[model samples]
Target: MWIFRNKSFKSAYISIIISTLIFASLYALSNFNKIGLSFYDSTSSSLPTKPKIQEKSEWLTNFVDPLIGIKNGEVFPGPCLPFGVVKVGIDTNDAGYTVDEAVTGISRM
Candidate 1:
C-alpha cells in the first residue's frame, strides 16, 4: 500500500522488479553451459538402452472367455482383477444378450 500511495514510487518499484527479473533470466541463460546441464549426450554407448517390456503369459488367458455373453449369457465378461471393483467389458444391452437379439460388435462399458 505504501509503495503504491505515490505515483512516482509505484513506477520505480515496478521498474526495479522487472529489471531484477530480466537480470536473473539473462544470468541463468549466460551460465547455462557452466551449469553442466545436458539435453543429449553424444558420448553415450551405441548399445541398446531401451527398457525391456514385460510380456504377459499366454497360458493365463487360454481358459478365459471374453465372448461368454455374446450369445446367451446375461453378463458382460472381461478381464478383471480379483477383489477389484473396476471391470472392463462389452456393454451390449442393459439386460445383456438374449437368444432373439444378435450382437453387433464389442463395446466398452
Candidate 2:
C-alpha cells in the first residue's frame, strides 16, 4: 500500500503483474499437448503431413544450381551450404577477367 502511493511504483507493480500473467498464459498454450489439450480438431478430414524431401532436393538442384552460375565466373561454382559465411570454389580468372583459364588453387570467398 505504501509503494502504491507513488505513481511510478504503482504503474511498475501493475505492469509486472500483467506481464507475468501474459507469460504464464503463453507458456500454458505452448505446452497444451503435455496438459492433455489438443489444439488440432480430430474431426478434421485431413491431417497435416510433411512435404517430401526428394521434391525439395530436386527443386533446389534444378532451379537454384543454374541461377547461381549466372555471375560469369566471379561467383564460385561449388557446393555451398545455405547461409554459409565462407564459400570455397575455383577461380576461373585469377590473372584477370580477360584470361579464360582456371586457377590451380581453390579460393575461399
Model 2, 1-109: lDDT tens digits are: 3546689888998899999999999998899899788978888868887785686656755654543543465654567777767777665544432235656676676
**1-109 in candidate 1: lDDT tens per residue?**
4546789988988999999999999998888878898555768786468797656764567778766665655554566566645556544455674545556666444
Candidate 1 colliding pairs, count: 0
TM-score of each: 0.33, 0.43
Tell me how far candidate 1 lies from the true structure as C-alpha RMSD in angstroms.
Answer: 10.2
| Worst 10-residue lDDT window, candidate 1 | 84-93
User: Cα lDDT of model 2 overall?
Assistant: 0.69
For candidate 1, what is the TM-score?
A: 0.33
Checking candidate 2 for backbone clashes, the offending pairs are none
Best lDDT goes to which candidate?
A: 2
